[model samples]
Target: QVTFSHCVPTIVQMLLNAKAAQGTDFKGWKITIGGSALTRGLYDQAKARGMNLIAAYGMSETCPLISGAHINDELLKADEDTRSTFHLKAGVPVVLVDAAIQAADGSFLPADGSSQGELVLRAPWLTQGYYNEPEKSEELWADGWLHTGDVAVIDEMANIEIRDRIKDVIKTGGEWLSSLTLEGLISRHEAVRDVAVVGVPDERWGERPFALVVLGEGRELSAAELQAFLEPAVAEGHINKWAIPQQIAVVSEIPKTSVGKLDKKRIRSEIARWQKEGSAEQTSLS
Candidate 1:
């Protein structure tokens, strides 16, 4: 079994090389990918090697593995696109667990799939409250449900696909761009080791996405290649052309919080410092 908590291309390459060296037929190998969004390219590569790949979805609050793809005959016989869609989806709710989407005002939305709202869950196993923090517990359950702090869109099949964190959605030029989406896309490139996408001030576009990339050791890639790779996605309307990011800065590493999530506050501070110093060499990517 192979898993990718984050979509690191080098790890994918290692898996492919190992598979080739083994020369063993992939009929029995089960490769399950989770944690971050899996790219179509990586999914296709694993499929070509005859490996059984599945997608799993969960979070730390849910004890992980809330729901996972079933390798049943029905799913196995599905078309490539269907399978890919399933792979991208968050999957159905597990038995004995209840989930719903709620608005900011604490009203539940209908399961119509078009409504965008915060995810609220009720599972028997979830923690009753934060340890030694009654106030925090009350705040978390203000609406009588476990507020997951995640924004998601459910489909007709009841598959909950996470869109972005409510706070991470950047409003630029009358549209919202998911930082998670941009990060996932940028991390797919071979040169990238770690990436963080954030919205920075723009005189024209209101707020534009900027990528802070930590390149893999000994790998060199230009900004033009990254732009070109994202062009097709823009053309396909997956994201706005303007959202393709105005700049890509190759940094040593991104600062992270103690919990390991990208520390956007630090990046914002760095950008401000650079702007104030008039550091043209470090600030300009083009």
Candidate 2:
């Protein structure tokens, strides 16, 4: 009869793996995931282990409760897979929270699902300003909304799906590729125990995705194998062929921040250094 608990996706992954290893069932435990996006693969894994997961969106500046997934009768009628897709969204704004997307030009975007922009918020509980830091506070509260720095889309259902961090998006051939989306697709591979996808500077394309992967125990995978595995997704129009990483590194572990979020900055820096030093662990899929 335990109620829902809150955690980041990393904690959920660790718990799921540990409990499964110990032959323990989650007993239909409910977990509210925040701090980062929960991948579809992780959701599937948790469901298989008898865990119910819900995704949410917020930050320290907002008293940490901006939006949350809500299940309705219509949603309940959908298949588990379909429900999971909705469950993974950032969801409609919570009570007392006003959320909107702001374009680069400071105009509000429509809740059309396809219009992606920076998520902005205005809630009573949101922090007014940085303590004794007027300049920083002004920037944070610019245009009267708390900037979230998260690129997101709001569907007709008012479900807000975070596409990526504004800084982490990959710009290639004048199109944007979501590193989070790529990581989600890559996580579906059987051998990927842990993964991170980062955009690296490319002289030709402006930027290109690079993957760092950690394989499961007793599992082996190559860059070519991973590239081939993603081909079906490309054909299905889930991702563009150019979105595939031309190079991948099979690593013992992917870097994480002190708070357990993927450390993309560090990952990018490591890749740059590795490329300069010519690491033997790096593989060329192209």
Candidate 3:
């Protein structure tokens, strides 16, 4: 009975699960996904269910408007495979919003689609500061631009593709790994119902990626199985072998924030506690 909906990627995923359980037809649902990165795996699943899904980008600070997946005449005429390449991106900035990527050295990076850095914005509608929080406000608008805290890259067409959050990006073996990318790849597995990857402290590598996964009903998955599944991605140079999670635990649930985004902070604490108590299933490659 729903014609249109606007929600985060998590909500779209939940709706897909509901549709499967209820066996309902959603051939004409127009759903816009915002608030977080939309993975290709989720997009494919939603498409298979006949849901018309689109990706968007914004934050509470920007009056919740910035970019979206633009489907123009050419895009509309293209096949799903061709359309998804553009649809999965954050798209060009909306009118009045100037977007840029700032590197760690404070230099503005190029919009070459490969230079990843913190996404900064300048728009008339952006929030100026936190209420009664001068220090935080100052940080938010450092160098006269609102810092979004999201690491992203911009292509020649001005499309923005969010890579990962600054705090959540994993630094292992002197290379940065996008947790979002890892999760997206993991979610492609047929047995994976939900997945979250976090970087845990490691002595030799500085930090190692750990994954927590939830399997579909009556399905089973193991760390070895997942690594085997991801081998092709590594072979194809989508990710390095070291980027493969050193540990994976199948859990009944992955915690979520009030708004339904994955609660990575709580997940980190849970992993710590689980390791301390020897309850976590430790699956590591030799």
Model 2: per-residue Cα lDDT over 174-284, one tens digit each: 988999999999988978877888898899999999888888778999889999999999999989999999978888777788888998888888788887887736542
Query: For candidate 3, lDDT tens digit of each residue in 1-286?
Result: 8989899888887877774556778889988888777777888888888888888899988889799888889878998777987878888899999999999888999999899999999999899999999999998998889999999999887999999999999999888899999998998999988889999999899889999888888999878999999999899898998998879888878888898888899998888887887877743211
TM-score of each: 0.74, 0.94, 0.94
Please provide the root mean square deviation of candidate 1 (C-alpha atoms, Å): 4.8
For model 2, the run of ten residues with the poorest summed lDDT: 277-286
Q: What's the lDDT for candidate 3?
A: 0.87
lDDT of every model, 2 decimals: 0.69, 0.87, 0.87
Tens-digit lDDT track for model 1 on 75-146? 679987777767755677789777788887878887776687887888788767888999988866755577
Error of 1 at 238 (Å): 1.2
